[model samples]
Target: MADAELYAALGQLKLSYRECIVLQKIEGYSIKETAEILTCTEVQVRNHTERGMKALQKLLGGEIDEIG
Candidate 1:
């Protein structure tokens, strides 16, 4: 898809700016690292990721099996 389309998909995910920042910027981290850096639990991080991905898929009009 085009970059605009990708961004539009991301936008439809309903993530706050901060949540988007953490996911995009800290993507290099392991689950533990992500939780530690975000000051949240691994479960929370996973939940956000899942929800965000689902939203993105809805925006993209497809089923997204992965985010990366």
Candidate 2:
């Protein structure tokens, strides 16, 4: 998908603030770093990443490979 479409879909996911942050930041940063940035524990970061990605996956028609 195009960048614009992807971003639009992300916005439509209705994710929490932390979920968005975790998903976007985790691309280059480690879970530890993401937790630091969000001022939360590493487990929270993992949870947010997992939930956010699942929601995004569902929104994008369950295309696992397309997302990862």
Number of the top lDDT candidate? 2
Candidate 2 accuracy as lDDT: 0.63
Show pairs that collide, candidate 2: none
lDDT of 2 by residue, 1-68 (tens): 66665566678754563354434543667777777766888887777777777776677677645432
Stretches of model 1 off by over 4 angstroms after superposition:
16-26, 63-68
Per-residue lDDT of model 1, residues 2-68, tens digit only = 7576766665555543374346443556767767767888887777766676667667778545444
Q: Candidate 2, which ten residues in sequence have the lowest lDDT sum?
A: 17-26
Q: Quote the lDDT for 58 in model 2.
A: 73
Tell me how far the alpha carbon of residue 54 in candidate 2 is from the true structure, in angstroms, after superposition.
Answer: 0.5
C-alpha lDDT of residue 16 in model 1:
47
lDDT of 1 at 17: 34
